[model samples]
Target: MRLIAGVDIGNSTTEVCIGEIDNLGNVTFPASASCPTTGTKGTVVNVHGIKSALKEAMAKIGKDVSDISLIRLNEAAPVIGDTAMETLTETVITDSSMIGHNPSTPAGAGQAVGKLIGFQNLGSARQNEPYILVVPARYSYEDIASVVNRINGMINIEGIILQADEAVLVYNRLDKKIPVIDEVKQIDKVPDGEIAAIEVALEGQGVRMLSNPYGIATLLNLDAEQTRKVTPIAKSLVGKRSAVVIKTPAGNVKENVLPAGEIYLSGEKDISVNLDEGAEKIMKTVADAGKINDITGQSGTNVGNMFERIKTGMSDLGTVEKSDIHITDILAVDTLAPVKISGALAGETCLEKAVGVAAMVKTHHLPMEKIAESLRQDLGTDVVVAGVEAIMAGLGAVTTPGTKLPLAILDMGGGSTDAAIINENGEISMVHQAGAGELVSMLIQTELGLEDRHMAEQIKRYPLAKVESLFHMRLENGQMTFVEDSIDPRFYGRVVLLSENGLIRMEKDIPMEKIVQVRRDAKRKVFVTNAFRALKTVAPDGNLKNVSNVVLVGGSAEDFEIPEMLLEEFANYRIVCGRGNIRGCEGPRNAVATGLVLSYVGEMK
Candidate 1:
């Protein structure tokens, strides 16, 4: 018989499952064990911590490191999203330069004579001609409106050319029956008080007599060479996505293009994928695999970086060499806005900032080759990484098999909240966001001004029991315990941290009731709020009606009151909510690790 050991290294714990495979290809679970993960969820590798877990797990199955024949590892991906970029508008100070003109729609274009006011005086100014409004593209609609209103009385306002959306609104409000084109390519640098042409297409109305530069030349009685000048402005409006041509009676407009290039990633195989059409497809492909064991740079996540850091730490400590470390499997879901990045350069859209933020919110999984490898590396001997959605699906596969599409999974971990949606076709959508158990602990610490993070964590995790008078209490194991007579009333609701001598007390004489209230409130804000938000974000089409089953997983899911709290909040949707029954024994906490083993088996097949 061949034995396969599935290891899952998580952020908080390491879980190992030993299974035996026979010639028929059936796998049977033999033994399983769990221990605290060596390092911070995804950050460091503690060789000693991992060794302890491995020893304990192996001992359960009466097997040593050499009993396993093959090993698989998961890949890690880190991503960042939801970054805000603020740009200050209306902050340019420069000498008036350039001319810009836009006409909504023209009927046979012609040049009009005009003088530029703001920058026209720099050159020759024609006092006896109509003036055109030259607006820059960078200005906001309000700013453009203000400028137009300010020059309304002073200038003829023959046409209002602008850089922003104001042009459309301004043109709509024009009193005269003048032709207007919406978007003008370049308006800032039009020459002042010069003879220029504005062109407009006449669908069937033919060319307007006023639109013809020659007509203007006839009216002004200009020479043939001078009449040719307005032709350029008419030509500029052609083929533009949206353009407005104002027959500038006097000024000329010119257009120019800017230089830009795309950046690509260095030292790796480059792949180009269009984000607009490809994001959902790619996400679906990754999700449908039921389980993704290893994804290198292809998927970005917070856990990926955590595993890399642990690997580096292990190598530095001489516990394991870099080559010995192998990432067998990795599960990462993009919790970012739908922004795409191409090559190595910033995306033209808001994707750059999203990528930056996703990089900060990453997670990963790693598997050692053998028991000695784990012992030497000082990492979690048992490691499993799976998307929260996949875990929920596995649970649903066991509990409610013939359900509808798009089942939801709310994974309330210590550091962050994760939510995933699995559809009937096995397509999955997942999201990770800040605010979970750790956030609750932080709130408690801050509100109560406690210095011990451990104390805060304990307070957030367990129920409180106040020491009432010096009465004898029965322990869970039927042991009798007696408290001291001189205990403060503040310790009435607080649990006793038994020491070598006597019961411990908090530094501050804060009431236990207040602490319990604060703790509960913190959990409500961080976990409950985050769970709802994450669920809404991951559901297909942002509709909750599609999700009928929500399986809770992760350490936080084990909280006695948390599951009920979520059930109450999500009751409106007629959804069935409960913890995952991993292997029909372990609770939701082992879902990831168990799923990792199942994923490994599937990949081998």
Candidate 2:
């Protein structure tokens, strides 16, 4: 009997499979293990992760790394994916006129318009004159509430903006409640003695009056031209719980359509599509240009800077010449990114329409041989680069029990999505495309305004639930479950991810339904779209209708909803699509590693 081990080094993980082959050439797998990859794929740094995984798998079989007769590694092509967001338009305010933010808790529920006055000057206000109080953090919430109560009959206080986060506390202590907008970090920037309007929506609602441009015109008595200029301010205030719009003589808001620039596609023919036109048009232009050999962006523009950053990053990671690295594929998705308004109080952010692009970098060579030689010397065992990644994955996919001869496989991984088809004659065709799990996570993070990458990844990888009570939780599907033990208070009344470690509470104020919708939509925009793109490239005659069986293999295939989404999409074409079970044991994983060993044993026979 001869012992052999196969290793697959990927962008995000390293997998190994151990097998024993008899003299008759029959093979049986003994053990398998996987761990996070040490560094960039196709580099010598991967040997650390490879050795760790090998030691783990060997331990499972009561053997050591030295006992393996030979080791096989997939010929991994280094794929680097980089993403950037280009906002089509930006909101610039010349003066501090608008404070539009969705504070977690605001006070009161109404609209009021009056002259702005400092809290220290409230004592000198003329009786029966309407004024809005601007209070600083030096004054306590109790003192503010007490002073407002004392001046109730003498001064008409329409609203109040506090520099501290005491809106709810002050509102509750008041004998007469008024609109309170707190957490204004730059309260001193408020245009004192200017006419201002404040609007606070009730619970579970957004501001209605201030979010409308005509409504602001009615409150501030502005003409058609002034209303047109303030329209961008209103647009930024939409969906906000509380907003304040002040009218100043020199205040102006300009909605600038930024020069996002054009993408130049060098293929069978050259084509240029401007990013300002949006993602759909850009992608359509890309499709019209067949087989992209190189992609470039307009110089001195947002996309140009972004592409330069990507090129530099990839060149450094792969240690290749910058000129040799060509962007061969691009995936663009429409998204609304949170952009901070130019001049606004309270650090306000507005959702701006952006085109998020994921670019794929391909080079002529990578130092995979260096990695193999390093491993050979360290382990004192024979190691060789076996075969292409997609072809090997296709070979391992056929080992699935119910699969047939002519098979197709989609290796949905972190950095890129790869597809391969094997015919009965053993001929293989493969294609690698940009954008996969990482892009999906980027979309989730940008759309939901999440600052933590781990939270966004969790949102992408698992299902979500809303803790309805201490004992019962409502899932994304609207089903409720009861637990015997008391749940953690931190998770109470919050949308939590149902992850392997347990209920992880999401700190954002997003609703469960919206989170679920964003997650599924992101998956559809990336994976489902890439599935069709990859399958068409590898299918006969570039037609998905001609393809029959498709097995999803890789880490992303194990996601709770991605496979189901693809299965539903492929169903229309009568394609049998599902996650692959490698050797009828490993589910949607270790396919490339297993295929490396299988291909070696076949050569021996």
Candidate 3:
């Protein structure tokens, strides 16, 4: 009899399976253990998690890591999920600058070119100048409107800016129709005597003049240089219903680009493509190039620096050189990044469209080899690199109750999704693609325009609900439920992330239904699309119909709704799909580890 152990060091987890095989080739798994991955997959830092898991699995049978006759580790691919998406929009402010934010319920839709003036100081204000009166909270709507009407002939009052919610009321009483922007929380901050351009869109429309840099230039009579300088602020306010732009004092808005350099794809011949063209173009070039041996980024570009940094980091590890590192596969997603508007008050930001890239680098399997040698020296046990991760994971999935050959498994992990199948004849085929859990999280963060990644992660993991009342909450599916006690006041009137811990308040002002839709849509877009793509590639004849069953395994498999989503999608093709049950106990996890043990005994079918 021999005792063997399998350790699968994954992107986000480290799994271990321990078993004994008798002379007859029968296998019995006595214990298994798993821990969070400590560092990058396929790196030396993973030894911490591997050691911890190995000790735990060995302890289950009253044995230690030293007692194991041999150890097997999966050949984990080097896939890195890069969240460095850059936003293209920024705020630019020149002299007399104004920042625009959406204010609910403005009155009298029309564009007005004017000079902003203080309401009280209008007595000293110059005549023949187009005037936009700024009203404070201390004055009543009735009194202010009456005063403006009385002074109508003497002053050219084209627009009104108010601190209170009285834009409609004041507009109704005015004899001369004028645009009014009300509910300005900081009305006192509007500088007087500045060249102001106020635009209130017609109901159901958006402001045009203030949103366009050229329009602002036309209204403010700014030169070409000034218009170029003000473009960022205009871009920042592009979609608002109403906006106000003022020429402020000499604060410059420099639109800086993070150089995500060119991608060098090696195919029929080597060709370089710009990363700024986005992922679609880059991947298309890669496809056209035929088989891509490796990809690297341009020097000083964002992506270029990213690749260089990865090489520099690995080189710092002193185990691998830069040349041995090869980017085997890459995944990119369209996303948004927030850039603060220059001279923006109240921390205004614009969500700029960007591409989030995740690359899977092949490191000549030296990282795994180093790990094997280290373990052998430390534990006095023989160690070997089993094989590719996807094939091993398929071997592990067989340990699931009632699973058989001629089926496929989708390993939806954090960095990449792996699909593999084991035929009845014992042949195995596999493929790995970029995009999975972290990509979904990136999509959520971009769509929701959130600043905090921790919140974005929670949003990805949980369902959404609106804390409508203190004692009742409206679920994402439009169902309402009552609580025994009143909900927290902080969560009231806010879209919340319903995580395992509790309700997490979202700072962004979005409806719960919208938030829920974006979250689910992002998952469906990444996982469901990848699910079919994976199945079709690995299935017989490259058709999904050829495969009968698919088992999902990985951290993403644990999501509350991803499995259901994939099931519904697969149902259309007459294929059955469900989360894997490794060893009939470990749910959607440790499949590769168990497969290692089976492969060791040569009992794998």
Candidate 4:
């Protein structure tokens, strides 16, 4: 009988699974175990932690390490991806210089020359005088009507240039029709005392008299050279990026080209790009072309370098050489600082940075020696990588299929939140975030002034209960029990121990109520918020609307309220939330190891 083991090394904990594959290709998971992850993830810190988890899992299956024939490990990409989400929380006003307005159709033939004034400012004495009408975005059609009605007889209201949609509304409201452009983003940028032309075209209608640069100049009684000046403004507002444009009626518009190129790199090394080309040129460059580096001196996300790192490490270890190792098949999800691109026309674009989780082996026939070598080099440590064939075989297990074409597995471990997305097309994306259970523990330790990370972790993991009297006590699980004998007075009204030790008091007289409140709030802020943010970033459009289900696994997911809280936050998207059943017993916590094993089987096939 051939047995395989899967081990997932996470930031807070390491999970192990053991499985057996029969001659018919059916896999059975017999046992699973979880222990705190040793050392920093992606960095070789503690091998003992991982070894202990392996031993515990092996013992559960009633087998020793020698019984295992082969092992599979997930590709340990050294880079960690970090992500942050911030919405427009406040609105601030700035000095108006640019306007973006859209007017689908406008009336009149050419440029209208006149003094600009607000709709309300027009009066009777200006009836024959040429004028430009200005509209504010906030005002409704009704509001514009009231102002126009009051000054109807006093001003000519000769030419109407309003906000994008307002043009149509104002046109319908007028007794006599005039040239109007509706969608205008910037009404504040309209130059005062300038000869501006408004271009309008109806459905199936070409440019009118106002459409020609010279025609507008004729209408405004300007010389040919002067008319050329206004033409530029009229055309500027017509394209995709332009929201609005106000120019001299005679100015002409011209288009210019910018040359560019793109550079792609692979590996964890940092790189720098020299800005030999112009900013616009850089923006136009395509992906995976030209020279690039692993580590970029400029701050930004680098996927190419991440890919290179994983590949180099794997290649050196002979994983790709001895077996069919496919690096491109494994999606690299980065959760890192947003890369700040300096020479792009779009301004500072945030490039996705974190390269956290990766799936290396596929097919069961791949050689293990090469796999181990690759893992050691890439992970930068002496590695013992293993894969289990099945996650539920020995235990009383129920197999539940998952919904959602692209499913995300979130390993909410202690030190970090590891996430991976497996699309229906078999494409996998993964990322590792730095802050996780450890961050929560730090918060609790700092808030309550506790010096111990272990104590803080326990407090963050469990709930609190106060011991009211000697005869009765409360538990963190919300259950109450009675004691036969009188307990110590110090334990009364203090946090009660749920362990076999009975009631015990906390050190230094810390209040149970304060401890509970602080722990709960801290966990919610760190874990829940980070989970949602991570999921959204990995989602197709960075929106949860497309994601309906989130599979949560890890030591942190064991918390009773954590999953429920996630369900509530993602309820709007109709998401079904639950844990992964590794070996039919360990929920959602052993997916990486299980996946690692499954990846091995695919390699053999």
TM-score leader: 2
lDDT of 2 by residue, 435-454 (tens): 88998998999899999878
What's the TM-score of every candidate structure? 0.47, 0.94, 0.77, 0.48
272: Cα error in model 3, Å: 5.3
Task: Name model 4 segments beyond 4 Å from true.
Answer: 42-47, 77-404, 475-479, 485-490, 497-504
Query: Which tens-of-lDDT digit does each residue in 1-605 have in candidate 1?
Result: 77656555544666566667777676676777778766543334634454565567668778786666543322222311111111111111111121222233432233343443432242332333566555666656555455546655454545444444454565444444333334545444455454333334345333343345565456446576655754433232233222222223333323221111111111123322222222233333333433333233322323233344534554563434655643322222212222221110111111111111111233222233333354434433333333343443343334333334456777666545667777677677777664466556656665565667787776666554445455653332335557655556655544554444555555655556677777777677556766766777787777777678888877788876788888888887877887766566667765554555566566568
Candidate 3 regions with alpha-carbon error over 4 angstroms? 1-5, 18-33, 51-72, 78-98, 103-113, 117-124, 127-192, 199-242, 247-262, 268-282, 297-324, 336-353, 369-388, 532-545, 568-573, 600-605
Predicted candidate 4 versus true structure: per-residue lDDT over 87-162, tens digit per residue: 1111111111123222445544333445666654554235566666777677787777666666666775656666
**Model 2: per-residue Cα lDDT at residue 426:** 89
The per-model lDDT (C-alpha) reads 0.48, 0.88, 0.80, 0.52
Candidate 1 Cα outliers beyond 4 Å, as residue runs: 41-48, 76-406, 472-507
TM-score of model 3 vs. true structure: 0.77
Ranking by lDDT: 2, 3, 4, 1
Model 1 accuracy (lDDT, Cα): 0.48
Residue 43 accuracy (lDDT) in model 3: 70
